[model samples]
Target chain A: MTSDAVSAGGDPRRLLADTRTFARRVRVAQRVTWLPLLVLGVVTFGAILVQAVSRPVTTGCRTTDAGEICKVWNPVLESYWLVAMVAAYVVIAGGYLRVARARGLGSRVRPYVIAGVAAAVLMFTLIAAGAGRWIVPDPHDLLNPSTSILVLFRLLTASGGIGLALLVLAWLERNVALLLFALGYLAVVLVPINFGWGSHWSGKSEGAAQLIVNGLVLLLAGAGFALAQRLRASR
Target chain B: MTGPVDTPAPESHPVTGLDDVVHQRVRLGILTIAHEARRVEFGFLRTELGLTGGNLSQHLAVLETAGLVGIEKGYEGKRGRTWISLTTAGDAALAAEIARLKQLIARVETTVPRQGEAS
Candidate 1:
């Protein structure tokens, strides 16, 4: 382990210089893992766009005492979107844990596990609550054929995003850029839903909105990555 | 003419109070990396530090013996892997080293005259 720097009685200057070198190395190491995940996100997002544009819409009907309720269902879009989301979550979680581990911060995994479990429990609890009619009278609103999956997707996004953000913030308390990335990604996922722009093939404006949101998300992510690299390089 | 004038030897420079175990380049690298990560894989440490398998294991053993790092061996998809992480004591030690380094830098800045000032 002895080197010219180390053998120099651990001089503060040497230590600082060495630290910077090590940090740069760590950042380079992390980029190897992060790049692939970024690629995966882009590919998944592209697939969702493709499915949204081409999939045929089917109508789903349900009989009730008052009348029959009907709604358009884009199964292709829904299924593909759900798969993409799940894949994203898996990739994000796995990549995060791997990178954290590589950097020697394995203790941070606890929060991730806790967040995941909490999210799953929340999802089931919502489902059960809706089933029991304890909340909304219409279970369909909470877990209907059209909205249930979307709700689940949103819940997963919130849980995963918030959890990862909290963990990263706790680890790198000074890195506000990470927090921005997390919040930005969360907003990118939730904004359209909040505005009632369902993730289905509707029209040109919908597609345009999706593209804009995705672009913003990628920008935020890229910024966060760049900031991390810069921070590591500087110190 | 005088043959030579006395000058301070480079070897006479002041020493830092950094821990001997933590001072080694490879060990310092390990600690720094571990401090950033929650738990690091043995393979990652080896790759990042550019150490051979045997060499990294030796250093990890030394850190583990010093109680500065913890090592866990487990199986990952039929392959055995080792995970290394800093203990609480290790974290404190690394923080102290960094603090000392910062102080040393500051002290040097205040006491040492630059070329322009010396002129």
Candidate 2:
């Protein structure tokens, strides 16, 4: 029994470092960050197909002092996202449960799922209440003075909501990596970069192209984290 | 380096402060993992420490007997699983062990010179 004792008589720093490393391994083993990221990434990426097939209808036009602001509605895209996001949330929760059971670990994935589904519901509600008209940028009104407000409104979109909900997930996980990814994803969602170059290559719309970029970020982050965990575990 | 004048008493050494039950290599590893995870599974502990089920169980039994760890034997689904968590006493013991280890490190580092350094 005495022989099994750690020889703290030796360099304790190495011992401390080894202990910390083992703790990190345990943490990485239990994390399901990659699961949610991959799932959400696929959903966001798939939205491009829905966007491509659905035609935007100019429902109505309102005359304001600034100019004519027309309401653009894409019922198909909206409906598809509503179902997709809900399903994604369910799948993520189930995935966590499965992994936990298989690995004999406990999972705190419920709050994240709840938060994600809530965001999806909130987006659907806003759209149902006619707030969706205000979200889309009207082609006719080019230099709208409320551009900042419009950007803020992006938080209500599916991608933006996913980003926002991830902050909740990050908090629950207490993982700095997830928190950083969530912040980065939120920035991309709010002020989407025009990846029109990718659109031309893929023959997809600019909207779809942007979604693809967001989706790629999710997928890459997911894969990167999973790979890192595996490497750590192997070590 | 100055010549040593008098040796300290053995009981005054930082290593003396280490709890025998918590200071063992496997038991220390278990406590550290449990402290970090808050709640850890028995399988994870066994795998992480590279210990057999019986070996890990013996260590866990020692920890439980010392009131350092709380172990639960329950079923996750149809399969029964064991979960290990640090009790308040366990948490305090771990903290104390680390603190002692740090003190031990500091003492050794200050008294000992690097290989390349002038003695």
Candidate 3:
């Protein structure tokens, strides 16, 4: 609130010069926050979520065989979510990219966005270890024995990498945000009972996965708000 | 008389140089706006400073000639955009001007200490 910039110990002359650069960065930082990163990311997430919830029920066999009815759309539903997850990654990655680009972060932003994507990739790597299960009727392999401790540990490490990168990004930007939630998700999943819930969330319709994924998405939205407000108020 | 001098001194005391630059409202406003926003479009500066087309043009010309500003043009989409940024010389001058103002305030504050006591 003290606009003239002088503070506890610095000479009046020193304060003005210090404020000069700070004010300049703050001005453009607004431009960066208002960029389209957050909204687009959230929308993509919503779309993926809607598909997860509704697709299984809506897409079914057109032909009527009564007791012998065969569904053509089941395979599409099984694969549709995979494509949705990839799109979700793209949108989420874009949100972080926008924050970096608008801030003129130069080399500072790349590593963080990379880390988040790496975490996503590591999740897929765990999924690959359970690819044997996904091959037939059951895609809910989150806690299946085939998932393996080694795969889970690698996925956890990847999440740790993401959390570290996001922390660094937030520190540089001077905001603490949904970073804790991201870290928390990895921790919650390590418990055997909670671990099954993740797969259950991803598979079971109108269930806990909706709650968790939507809640995580909301947390991301909160982080974006915190980031934008912090930018607007910086100088 | 002082010895013959071909050019003025490169740096001047506050009283010597500030008067010429400070009184031009448009240039000062431009400096303040650009001080807040490190750079702005030429049109934005004109609109924000509220100078007439010709008036803003003349003032900007003077600042540009004085090495206090630089202008460049580019296109955003099909529309042309002109960018204005304070040159290093301009930034230094503005910093010096702010310092000069603070110094003047410091001088006045000592004399007017009792006057501001109520607030």
Q: Is the docking of candidate 2 incorrect, acceptable, medium or high quality?
A: acceptable
Extract clashing residue pairs from model 3.
Answer: A201-A209
What local lDDT does model 3 show for residue A18? Answer: 42
The lDDT values for all models are 0.59, 0.79, 0.49
Ranking by TM-score: 2, 1, 3
- Alpha-carbon RMSD, each predicted model: 12.6, 8.1, 13.8
Candidate 3 lDDT tens digits, A24-61: 44344433322223433353355455546554432322
Q: After superposing candidate 3, which stretches have Cα over 4 Å from the reference?
A: A1-29, A32-235, B1-19, B22-25, B35-38, B74-78, B116-119
Residues B3-115, candidate 3, lDDT per residue (tens digit)? 98799667544444453553244565566556555566666655544555576777778888888888777886697776677888888877777667577557656756585
Candidate 2 C-alpha lDDT tens digits along A4-102: 443444456866776788776766656888889999999987888888877766756777665776656677888888899999999999998777656
Q: State which candidate, 1 or 2, has the greater lDDT.
A: 2
Q: Which pairs clash in model 1? A: A103-B37, A104-B37, A104-B38, A105-B37, A105-B38, A105-B39, A106-B37, A106-B38, A106-B39, A107-B38
Question: Which candidate has the top score in TM-score?
Answer: 2
* A91-182 per-residue lDDT for model 1 (tens digits): 65677666655454453344444454455455444533333233334545534534545544454432333334344533443335555556
Candidate 3: lDDT of A231? 67
